[model samples]
Target: MLLKLDLTDSRPLHEQVAGAIRRAIAEGECAPGDRLPPARELSRALGVNANTVLRGLRALRDEGVLEFRRGRGVTVLAGADQRARLVDQAGALLAEATRLGYSRADLVELIRRLP
Candidate 1:
């Protein structure tokens, strides 16, 4: 998955990194057992500090979406079950948006605007 960050975004860089990874998992762009890029490499790609990448990876690990193996770098732990849960949550979010008078297109547009 290619990680993208909006430098102008108000959120912290680490949070942005974590969010992109989470979205990748949710969208099935990443699967269980996939190995993530090394922290230093990812940092270089994202033009951020290695510590920032490490922080993002740690957050994913804490969320059970990734695991750090001794010699395997960070491996994805998210699988079909995780994807299903994400779908359910997204459904709930869409329902709420509908209740708030947002159309499906509106929801899609909003999501498209996300980094």
Candidate 2:
């Protein structure tokens, strides 16, 4: 996978890593059931600490975009592209809402009130 990091980005390294992977998945750079490069390999390529890569991968797994299997390694989950896009959109919405002085509960309530 080709993971790109914007050195100028102010977000945490882990978040940038996750965003790169998420974009790759959304762009069809990888598909469902496709195994990801090992975290160490990714760290080496991205020039970040292995733990940082793992943290990003863990975040993806938590977002349901990737799955971790013993010995099988990390693989993209089915429907990951769509899910990743939705997750990204939700994140953007949350950030915007926060910037507007709204809390998480306010965002949730706003979403709930949507038709």
Candidate 3:
């Protein structure tokens, strides 16, 4: 999955990284046991620091959504249970977006613009 970044966002870059990865997982772009890109590569792709990528991956690991491994980089943690948890996470995000004045059309536009 690709992480399309918004450079102007007020949120920290690491959080954006984490949020994109989380969205990919939640939406089934990446699935159980899928390998994530290495920190340096992901950092380059997103135009952020390698450390920032790692920090975001670490945050996901702490949340039980990803696993960090030596040499192998990050991997999705989803099995059946984890997938269910991710769906809940997605639902919560969607609800929050709605609460914050995001319409379905807005989300569709955002996804449509992702590279």
Candidate 4:
């Protein structure tokens, strides 16, 4: 769910963080059974309060998009296969990049994947 921030955007940092996490979940960038960073950590990273992270998480949980356990923390609801799901979802990204004249190397650099 975590991604780079858009320094130029007018959106609030917390909203951006929440949106990124939401998109990741929707697109399978974060898979079922995946665990999110703790609220304090995310807040520190995003330069926001822990309560902001908590609100975002609670909103997602209320939407049935994530499960938050009191002590164990937050985890994606496990069922979908991470690899296959991401592969399918990434097809659109690949095509869009091609349409925009981006090479695989350029995409790799821009995305800068964790692994």
lDDT score of residue 78 within candidate 3: 54
Quote the lDDT for 11 in model 3: 71
In terms of lDDT, which candidate is stronger, 2 or 3?
2
The numbered model that scores best in lDDT is: 2
Overall lDDT per candidate, in order of appearance: 0.82, 0.95, 0.79, 0.71
Candidate 1 lDDT over 1-115, as tens digits, reads: 7889999987799988887788777777778888888999989999999999899889878767788999878988847338535754775798799989999899999999999
Model 2's C-alpha root-mean-square deviation from the true structure amounts to: 1.2
Give lDDT tens digits, candidate 3, residues 9-114.
7678888888788777767788888898788999898888899988988888887888878888778875623554664566577768888999878877876899
Residue-pair clashes per candidate, as listed?
0, 0, 0, 0
Using TM-score as the yardstick, the better of models 1 and 4 is 1
Any runs in candidate 2 off by more than 4 Å, and if so which?
none
| Between candidates 1 and 4, the lDDT winner | 1
List the candidates ranked by TM-score, beginning with the highest: 2, 1, 3, 4
Question: Against the true structure, what is each candidate's TM-score?
Answer: 0.70, 0.92, 0.69, 0.57
TM-score, structure 4 vs. true: 0.57
What local lDDT score does residue 18 receive in model 1, on the 0 to 100 scale? 83
Give the alpha carbon lDDT tens digit for every residue of 53-96 in model 4: 78877766765667888888898776434433454356558768
Clash count, predicted structure 1: 0
Order the candidates by lDDT, highest first — what do you get?
A: 2, 1, 3, 4
Q: Which pairs clash in the backbone of model 3? A: none
Candidate 3 TM-score versus the reference: 0.69
